[model samples]
Target: MGDDHSAARPLRADARRNRERVLQIAQEALASDGLTISFDEIARRAGFGVGTVYRHFPTKEALFEAVLLGRIERFVADARALATAEDAGRAFFGWFARVVEQAAANQALCDMLDGGSQAGPQVGLRPGSTLADDFGAALGRLLARAQRAGAVRADLTGRDVHDLLRGCLTAERRSLARGGAVRMAEVFCDGMRARTY
Candidate 1:
């Protein structure tokens, strides 16, 4: 999903195909192995040479950043779409749960959200960047809509919700039993729900 938007000439057809293949392979590896997997392993899995992998992404950090940005873009798109739902509370909570579940299963996402990776500080997403801002803005819109509908607690801010999400991810990541993450997410949703007198 990463593209070259620089002033450089466009890639040849074969080169473009190879780049896409490497990105796809790296995406899968990040999901399963986080940043622990090497470019050599990616090259081997991609059925290409290491030089091919380096041609597109000279460093492991570059490839990881590209993959992470792509994933975040997709998530932001989903949040934007969900913001239009008739049931604002369900839309917000449902999307939240799905994100937690998916991230719990994804090593790269978990590590990124945790604020660092085993590979080093340069490999993870930084706060206040365009990618984070886009996601936050989309989520903030959903939160505001839910609050206006009286489906969510009025006292909660977007940052509060994000903190809660991080907590849910942490709980899920640390839970020893299966379905712990799902259960914890449900608890969070319940806590976020508005109370009726």
Candidate 2:
């Protein structure tokens, strides 16, 4: 068997710039079009050929995994920042609401876990794997902080957030399919709020 030598690359600043631009453009395209965004569009917007995208990310799922990791990191960072928010419950609920909104807009992100795990070059991105783990790790830090601050409920786990987002995304997809987004967010947000004892 021949040894794989393709992993070696002398990092260059200019190359890094191009890759960053590609990531930014790809992120926007995915945000706007969800899973429907094509690699061709991402390449066009980034002023690069599909080859550049493939070079940076061999598969669409790899590129998607990167974008999602960014979202998860930023989301948790924001939650950490809000740990001392004026109202603890409000902080938790508001952060949850932000997540719900993202899921509402990008229902395809829900399939991210399952899709990444399917039979494809992108299967490396399984939700219980790297990309999802990145989100989970970030969430672990935030959840501990939020719980200590009495922001979120004590019994909730990070997986709960993932599960809840999945449900919300499913509901949002059905609602949009029916041309209705009315009170859906309200009901979801209400459910996130803690009960008054």
User: In candidate 2, which residue pairs clash?
Assistant: none
Model 1, which residues run further than 4 Å from truth? 1-11, 117-119, 176-182
Per-residue alpha-carbon lDDT of candidate 1 for residues 1-197, written as tens digits (9 for 90 to 100): 13464433355767988988999999999887878899999999999999999999999989987887787778789999998999999999998888888877676776676555444687555688787888889889999999999999999999899889888887877672454425678889999999997
TM-score of each candidate?
0.87, 0.70
List, residue by residue over 3-23, the lDDT tens digit for candidate 2.
Answer: 344333334565787789988
Off by over 4 Å in 2: 1-11, 34-38, 113-134, 137-158
Among these predicted structures, which one has the highest lDDT? Answer: 1
The TM-score obtained by model 2 is 0.70
List clash counts for every candidate, in order.
Answer: 0, 0
Which ten contiguous residues of candidate 2 have the minimum total lDDT? Answer: 1-10
lDDT, candidate 2, at 35: 64
* Poorest stretch of ten by lDDT in candidate 1: 1-10
